[model samples]
Target: MMDANVSDQRLRHQHQGLWLVAGIAGVLLLAAASIAIGAEDLSPGQAWDAVTAFDPADNRHLLVRHLRIPRALAALLVGAALGAAGVVMQALTRNPLADPGLLGVNAGAAAGIAIAIAFFGQAEAGAYVWFGLGGAALSGLAVYLLGGVRQGMNPVRVVLAGSALTVMFLALTHMVTINSEAEVFDQFRHWTVGSLEGRGFAALGAVALPIGAGLLIVAGLARRLDAVALGDDLARSLGSHPGRTWALAAFAVILLAGAATAAAGPITFLGLTAPHAARAIVGTAHRRLLPGAMLLSAGTMIVADMAGRMVARPGEVGVGIMIALIGGPFFIALVRGRRLGHS
Candidate 1:
């Protein structure tokens, strides 16, 4: 019996390894497709050459090099960041349905961006990144403090606090939007839609540090997160510091989700859907789960972005709109089908 159990475990591990490799391959393929399938069609060879070589005289090469490449990279990086942050937030709260956006992280970031544009008249992407990060960090701290988890942190309380805060920020955002000048509102509308258009490598460069640091922190904590899944007291007994682990996870979420939102505005449901889909395919072990979630998210976003560009026939549907269209039903189903705490 012992030998049989060991063999079964090994087989499961092998299967998981296969899934991870396959997922990563799919993401790469989707990214390549995204680059090739934009408005101006380019053969794979041309696109490859365009990306590699520089010719100021060649408009096609310049477009591919300066536009599509950076846009594709932004989609991949933002999707990966949101996916990884979603997994961390879900694990930290022990709630399968938890999403970074739903927990006020995105709202806080959006609010910050809106305020910056309305007051400062500065709507630049680089400046928005800092504002968004600051807002998200402050909101997350507020949620944690108000959630009232004295004996031990309760997922429900934290989620509730986050939800309330989200509602408040969203209301404030709308108020500001409504009262702002037409020109400011016009600019705000574009920023809110979440497009990958016209972005350069510099936008990706801005997020590299925070996203890289967050991913490293998450990777190192994979084992600890697994222990956390065993319950707080048990995790502590096993020599893991639950409080410190939770704080680190929260910080990771802020850095990742904030930067992504700042880069692409608010993308609805990628975080919620991606991690849950990954968990459904692979069981709830953090080590396997995080990578699967990241790949799935990256692939999903790339596909959605490609579809949006194609479906609109010259005009493109913004990524935010596409995600919302797909994510709305999924979110409802997840909420309706299960008891609140089961996740």
Candidate 2:
């Protein structure tokens, strides 16, 4: 018996090590591809040199450093935040379909941006960050209230509440958009279709702290979340406080999801699918699952961005469009096949 247990532990450790190696390799490959493939392609050598050797006169190098690099980083950050948020959300709600977009968080951020443009005369995407964050926080609170979270909400109730809020916020956004001036609508229109283009270090800088803080909160709560995943009674028996875990999870979701939306304009379905993919690869352990999802998501975002550039040539499609094209089918398949209640 002792020998069998030892063998199992060794195999588990080996599997984890293999996943770690593969994850790092995947992120590196995606990052390199993102920097190299665009309107103007760069050879792998050139891309590596652009990062390693600085030259002010080389326009190719400048484009890599100033444009592609920032966009790649933004995609990485946004994907990571969304991926981590998705895992935490599914675990907390016990709903496989629970995601930032499905739960009304992204819609809330979009509504916030509309409000910022219409009421406050905010034009720059960076200027709307706080409003987006505020909206996400409020909408999350509203979902809990509507879902009767305190009354021990189940997965169906939670999703239903989220769906209701999503509709409400989206409707509000449309009304604000239609009533607003043409220019505001034009700006809002571009933002509503999520993209990683036109983002700079400034946008990244704005959301870094919030997203980082959220990740930390999730990490601290990960074990308790594992307990919670087994259900409330078992979690309490294991000395985990479900209420506190839920509150912290909510705050983390707002920070991560809001920051991603504010940075990337409410990209959909990455959160919905990333965690599922991660689970397939890394199983249910949050320690592996969170980072695994991040890498998978970041890689997917990079590939989507690269594909967008390829599919249209000089007239590139947006990353959001590419994600929707891919994720929409995935969503439909999931809905058609999966049982919709608690796991």
Best by TM-score: 1
What's the C-alpha lDDT at position 91 in model 2? 90
TM-score of 2: 0.90
Q: Candidate 1 residues 130-198, lDDT tens each?
A: 777777877787887776746566677888889999999889889988999988788778878887766
- What residue pairs clash in candidate 1, if any at all? 96-343
What are the lDDT figures for the candidates, one per model? 0.82, 0.83
Model 2 C-alpha lDDT per residue in residues 87-158, reported as the tens digit of each score: 988898777877876567888988998999999998776677777877887788888777776787565676
After TM-score superposition, the amount by which residue 229's alpha carbon in candidate 1 deviates from its true location, in angstroms, is 2.4
| Position 84, candidate 2: lDDT | 90
- Over the full model, what C-alpha lDDT does candidate 1 score relative to the true structure? 0.82
RMSD for each of the candidates: 2.4, 2.6
